[model samples]
Structure formats: structure tokens, C-alpha cells
Target: MGPRFFGYRDRVQDELVREGHQVECVDDRPSETVWFKSLAKISYHFTDRIILHYAEDLAERIAKEDYNMVLYLGGMSFCFTHRQFSLIRKSSNARFVAYLWDAFVNCKRFGQCRDLFDDIYSFEVKDCERYDLKLRPLFYSNTYRSIPLGSEGYFDYDACFIGSVHQYTKFKTVSSIVKELEAQGYRVFKYYFMPSRVAELWCKLTHRCYRGQVFQYESLNTTQVVEVYTRSKAVIDSPQNGQNGLTMRTLETLGARRKLITANEDVMHYDFAQYGDVLVWNSDSDGISGFMRSPYECPPESVLDSYSIKTFVQTLLGEAPPYRGYHNDDCCNETEDAS
Candidate 1:
């Protein structure tokens, strides 16, 4: 499988291979070289069709292959038209399935080819409710289990959140929460997409909002993230505004068997909450100290196994697994409450 962000595609390939299924992976992205990528990033602002040529080229390659299943993961900025989808379908006897992890923001672009896919799955609960799509929570790889925990002295912070920030209140809420935790004598190591002071000034000068960052540092890679997860006592989760579903950080915390401090109170309604693995804190609420002082309880092995990417891939391939942990109905009441 081709490498992608979070190594999610790599995890999928590993799981399918472990199940003894022969899988061939293909990448749809173009311009992997530094110079080409720089050019693409610059040209993207001038024309929406900057990536169209790449997509059409990839479609031609996909059309030449015959497979039983063609799965697309996380359609970020890729543009695929109906004609291209039709060509892909005609070329392969494979079932076209697209799994979108970022359905909330990318819906408009990804939804364009929704009818072309045989099966569509989204991580967002509201998207499923509104668009009649299947709801699947994001998964975590079992590899996290290899990281030994309980080494408190190794970390400088009690909790850490390494993710992108934005202009929205969700990210602003995170900054506030981090300060609150610090005031309560808890240490927090927070990182966002803000790269430099120059960039921040540029945004202000141009009157363009830095969409997902405040102060900038280079984002962590997979190895660096796993290292951080191993050292930290808990990971903080702050969902983007209007997104009711759990982020991958939630599942990653579960995989690492670490504690979770989240702004999403809806998580309290899920079965995983029954295990005491998570502490839900809202910006409007109190009790930051109590929750921080609470112990991290290890969830049952069954619970961990249920949410593994292995089981998720099996379910995707039409296998009935014993543990299908969270469902759309489980979050229905929470959704209603939020509305």
C-alpha cells in the first residue's frame, strides 16, 4: 500500500496481508518531489484545475488494472469527476469503496463522486444521518501496544495535544483548556500547525485567516507521535466545531492505553466511557483538577481488540466481527442533544 498521512493506508495494507489476502496498492497523488510539490502548492491558488491533470493521469492507470476491490482513503484535495469514476469502474471488476476520515469539511468535494462508489463509509456521525452513508469510527493500529507505558519521569508534561489549530473556536477552546490545566498545576505540551511568526504576520497582512494554526512548529511524524504517546500520561482531544464524531486521537489514545482529556462530552455516552479510559471536559464546565487527578484505568482487552484497524478492515471486506464497538445509533441521542 502507498504511504499516506498517519500511515493509515499502510495500516490497512498490513491488516489485509495479515488476513492472507493478496493486495496491490496504488497511489493517486502526483508531484511527490520537493520542487514539484512546492510548485503545486503555489499554483493551486491560481487555478482549481491544478490537480485535475494529476487525477486524470492516475485514473488512466487505475482503469488499466483489474482488481476485486479498489479502496480510496481520505480524499483530501484530490478531484475525481464522474467521468473518471466511470472509467475506473469500467476498467476494473473491483468494487469501488471510499472511506472518508474527514467527511465534515471535505464533504462538498468528496460528495461529488458519491454515486460512483459501490460502498461509502464516513467517520462523522452527522454525515451518516444526513447523507444516508454508513458510519464507521476511525481505528487505531495494534502496534501502539508495543510501546511500554507508565514511565512518568520521561515526559515534561502530564498531557499533550499534537494537532493542527485553526481560526475556529474549537482550537481557541484548546488553548484555554491548556492554560486551565497549567493553572491547576498540570503540565501540558501543546503543538499546532503554526510554523513561524512570519507566517502569522503574513496572514494578518493579507487578511487571510490561518485556517488551522496559531503558532507554528513542524508537525510530528508517526515515530515522533508514538514516542510522545508513550511518554505522556494523557492526550488532549479537541474536536473541530460542528464535528460530533471522535477524532483519530481518541482511538490512538485507546490503542496506547493512555488517558484522554477531551472537549467532546458526547464521548461520555459511548460504551468506552464505561471503562473510565476517558475524561470528558467541556470549556463551559468546571472540574479540571478532579479529572486530572483521576487515575487512568486500563480498558478490557476485548474493548481494545474491538476497535483495532484489523477488525475494521475485516468488516469492510464483509466479515462479521464479534466486536463492532460503536455504531451510529449509539451517538443518536448525543447528536439530538447537541442540535
Candidate 2:
């Protein structure tokens, strides 16, 4: 009902609930029969109808609740038409806010439907600057807290990467870095999501060593993800092609108290980077070996607290700093329908 489908949303809901907000989650993408998903994938017109139905169903349920806020996390709009969104918007007197996690790729859809939300926030600062959207970077879940059980010895891998091979740049960067690490005799684990059966077979044939690690694109369970994050000495990340900002992987590394080796130069702007908690390097750089050998430096407690899920939730609710530019006084006012 909450963040079950999307882990980041779940973490935000958990933080909001922990802070004493009675939260009611309406899953925008409810589990449906496999036949339903297969049909939705085949026909664009049918997909629209299915999504419209989902939105109407969700709106009806939400209209019954007394929620003071309605936050539409990313991906809901892929299914919702302007008509569906408007119906949901009018369902309650709640302040409507949207936080976009994939503005880099979904910019046009967001731009076309800008007026649907009373206030909009994006993880990419460029979106905020270029589109007048409010700036809000991603945050790490509190569940990544340090374990005092001294369990570091249980893991055999020095570094690990868990993500997809959808983008060519992402796949090339990760594969190159991991291959280099393996050549250097450093144990590394990687999980890549192949887009098709053919792609999976190709990966299995070419990279025989990674045969068991590759899988089809789908969601990985949170417990399994956290287990890998906590066990590894360092986590690896590569930004999307043309991406200039940080992703949840950067936040996850911080949350787990593990060092990060990323291609994201944005990390240099943060305080933790100055203290060597995170290293910004590319596949061609020789610094990774030395960086991997060094013990991870824990960033200051204040820095850690700043990037926590609680802070992100508080800021979204307009109860803390790093505000999202929406005020309670103007929150109830309706904007022009840009549909």
C-alpha cells in the first residue's frame, strides 16, 4: 500500500509516519494479472485505458480520505492522462505536490503537464533552473544505518554494482570498471538487467563469468538490495548518459556508510567528498585501486543527518530547511490546467 512498489517512496512514507503524520498510501500501480501487463505493453490505446481506470480507481479511494497532502511520486503520470490527474487533484482539499526522480528522461511529459501539480520538485537541479521547478535532490533511506555487529568480515567482494544495462553508456562504464577490477584481482559482484531474452543470451555468451548475475529488467527486493549494500566495502555507480546529477545510488552509499566510486562529478560539491568519504573517478583513472584499499571514512554526523530520509520528508512537508518553494497559504489555490 505504501512504498512496496517503489523503495524510495516506501522510505519517504516510513519517515513521514515516524514523524507522526498519519499517512495513507494509495498504490498508483497496483499488482495486476500477468495477462493485464502483457496486454498493456502491446497496445498504446489499451495502455491508456488501463491507466485511466487505475487513476479513477485511485481517485475514488483517495476522495474518501482526509489527507492534507497528496504527493505523486514519479512514474504515476506515465499511466495518468490530464483528465485523470485533474479528477484526482479535485478529489481532496489536500495540497498537491509532485517529486520527480527521473526528470532527466521525463522532461517533456512533465513540461506538458506542469500545471497539474500545485508545486513540483525535481532531483535534477538543472530541471529546477531550466523549467522553474523547485530543486530537491534524492535522499537515502534510514534503513541503511551502520550495523555494530562487526559483520564486515562476512563479505568476500570489495565492490559491487546493482543496476541495469539499459543505457549503453551505463553498461560500458560499469563493465569496463568491473573488468579492470577483476583483472587486478579484486573481487567484484555485479547485477545487470538485460532488456530482452536475446540481450541476456548475448551477455551470457560474451561475459561468461557474469552469466549468473544478469537478469531481466525488474525490481529487486529491498532486503536483498540492502544486504548487498551493507556487505560490500564500496558501492559502484555510473550516471545515465548526459546526466549531471546524483542518483539514489550515491545516497545509498552514504546511508550504508560505505565508500563510493562513481562517475558523478556532482559529489565534489558535497562536504563528505572533501573528507574522502566518496571518490569521483572514471573507468580510465588509476585512483580506484588506491581508493579501494583505503578504509572508508565516515562523514560527520551532521552531514549524515542532513541527507537522511527524515530530513527529506520534513523538507517536503514544509517543516524544515532546503524548502521546495511551496507555502501552505498558496497551497490550496488551483493553477491553470496546462493539459
Give each model a TM-score.
0.80, 0.79
Clashes of 2: 1
> lDDT values of the candidates?
0.69, 0.69
Across residues 132-198, which tens digit of lDDT does each residue of candidate 2 receive? 6666667887667754322447666788988877566677787777888888888887887666777
Instruction: Check candidate 2 and list the clashing pairs.
Output: 3-10
Please list the residue runs of candidate 2 whose C-alpha ends up more than 4 Å from where it truly belongs after superposition: 1-4, 29-45, 104-109, 148-155, 193-199, 202-220, 323-339
Clashes of 1: 5
C-alpha positional error of residue 138 in candidate 1 after TM-score superposition, expressed in Å: 1.0
